[model samples]
Target: MKKMPHLSFWQIWNVSFGFLGIQMGFALQSANVSRILSNLGADLHALPLFWIAAPLMGLIVQPIVGSASDRTWNRLGRRSPYILGGAIIAALAMFLMPNASIVVSIMPVLLFGLLMFALMDGSFNITMQPFRALVADMTPEEQRNVGYSTQSFLINAGAVLGSILPFLLTNSLGIANTAPEGQVPASVIWSFYIGGSALLLSVIWTVVKTKEYPPEEYAAYKGLDVKAEIDPQYKGFFGFFRLLKITPKTMIQLAVVQFFSWFALYIMWVYTTPAVSQHVWGCEIGDSASQAAQDAGDWIGILFAGYSLFAAIFSVFMSKIATKIGRKTVYSIALLIGGIAYCSTFLFEGGEMMHVNLLFTQVDVPSSAVLWMFPMIGVGIAWAAVLAMPYAILSESLPADKMGVFMGIFNFTIAGPQILSGLVAGSVLRFFFGGEAIYMLVVAGVSMFLGAISVIFVKPSKSN
Candidate 1:
């Protein structure tokens, strides 16, 4: 491809706007769902099993959607339609999720909502991939870093709001502080509604304002294959199946890293509240019948927001860092940093009284503030690479025509780790240490270091 003039700042901003909304949904879910599930009476060990729906749905949905979008064309275009569709589905799921505990058989209601959430999530991912491909397809090599950086910025901006919403609403508005047994708080409900609306509106703004280069215009970009050429014989199931075959070596390497990384994250999310409550608040898990459990849930939201806040800031500089060092080396260092953060959870335990400040009558400010803040900073840095590195590497390695399918397969690795974490982390903590939640963080630390080690082996893509 011939070198083109650099994109205007607004051009980069316009193309990346939709991610602002998408991250609102993603951050809310990642930060809050485990808290919601726990409040609804889900056992820690079984929490992962419930989350199974997310990955299971992704496994089925992302590739199919990716392949379909790859073949599609029209006024709406291939990717935009999926983005619009996902926004609608996600909006609906957000509306329904906070109310799940109110319905009959909380487990079933939660599962049904999770399914809807997964559908919406999958659609968003489908739209996301094509936008990424479009950036790579359209931007000059010199500006690719800037384009991706803009997108990551928008993503973290969305996450910042999404992560903070619950705490902001519940604390500031004086919304119903406590729900009846088995019900979600009014603050949480309102937050999801706001997130859903924000998601839809942001996506619409992008759809209306930004224009994708058509196949002919896009073809002008050097090194692009606009023909959408694939082996016609491979349209059938067997042909698709044949393309699906990946080297066992690659699969083993990716699968191991993905498993540990995702497992660690899942453990952190699922157990953080309980850990904080038990170790920091000195509250027994089932002993809280009032607003205490819900309060813990809110703190989790704050911590998540803190991490996302840093991620937004770090993303702006990630590309430069990747360029200065090798991408793999940068990623490895980031994961190690995150691992250190995870392991730091142990220091916060049993030091609650000295750490917390009693600001007002009967009101104690959390003493372990430094513990949470420092790790969150590390998380933010690690997240920059988590968002970009693997996909960047994979994009460089795969053939253009196979991008969607291979990316879909990659999603499985990401989701599979979450599934494993949820299934095992809580039970292991419960069984081994009589329900001490800090152990889960230890597990996460170990897993993160493993992911760092795995980074050493990912060969840099020459094409990229």
Candidate 2:
């Protein structure tokens, strides 16, 4: 068996460069989707239901794309074709989602927005699963940590830009942050446009720059029979279930951690805008139309950006840190810090004001909200680990030929939790917490702490 050659840093970077754009689109969706839905007249309690589209789409799309990509070998390469196709559709969805109000006569604006959201998320899943397989396929075991961390860095870097774009547009470029009732804001609309453009262009760069190893060569590197077909038991509709039964012990252990981590993430993405608005900006609950609510929404973008920035910086050293301390330790510690960060929001009072410098301009924002940035540092640390460590660990245990399909199956841990979260989070917020979004974040914190503990049980491959 020929060992997979070590790729140069630039080669690894090019392999995962598309993730920057994919994450940019994702960050935009995360930071602004609730705001858009609120403006489109989605009730606060129903936001979770609407958000189910994202994880639902991921739950369905990823494994299918993963399975198909495993069998695919084309001129554009196994993963790159799906990556490019998904990018195109994702960009189109980005363009259409914020403009759903424009199609109100064709369908209800809120419904249109939700459909677009589903489409965008589906496309994102299509692109993302393949990218994960690509990294695992191209990199040798020794380089997997570096490959995934680089991907994490790019993902967070893109997230920073995507998360902050609306704030930048509103404060720096003077785009209107608030819009007429039932319409998305100009700032958000423009941010989606820019994000879509970035997504398409970045994916193109990866498709153009990176070359996949041919089947024979790839089989040689991974010590597989070049002419061998996929195992019969791993085929057809029930095949995924069969594959699940035989999944690696490491993958199964990691699933528990993924569930809690992604559950907390789903809560953060769905509730953060409203949580910050009511908790730290003094906006009335369900007041999406108010100036205060709009201001809070815009500020949430900055807060999301702050966390992503911290995550990006942290990811730069994640591989080295994981190397020294062990991956599970790093994963556990990061989640613990993130759990504390989420719980800390309760301490801030919304009255104080602070002037922040942005793009060489000063803007006044709630000082209490600024304090959120400190917690975001911890959130960022956890996020860096969340994006990199599990995959790094799992890739070592996976069969080389099944990498794409298994990666897709692993996403069940991610999507399933978010799906469960979406189903119950609204009810939890309303009944348990008296309609307070902030309390849901506390729930998220506890979930993260559980994830921290769960990571301790995962035994990595001996190579690690």
- The 10-residue segment of model 1 with minimum total lDDT is 354-363
Q: Candidate 1, residues 62-126: lDDT per residue as tens digits? A: 76776776666679765677777777787888888888865655457656556655665666666
Give the winner by lDDT. Answer: 2
> How high is the lDDT of residue 285 in model 2?
77
Q: What ranges in model 2 sit over 4 Å off?
A: 462-464
The per-residue C-alpha lDDT of model 2 at residue 376 equals 90
Look at candidate 2 and tell me the lDDT of residue 142. Answer: 86
Q: Sum up the clashes in candidate 1.
A: 4
Using TM-score as the measure, the top candidate is 2
Models 1 onward score TM values of 0.89, 0.98
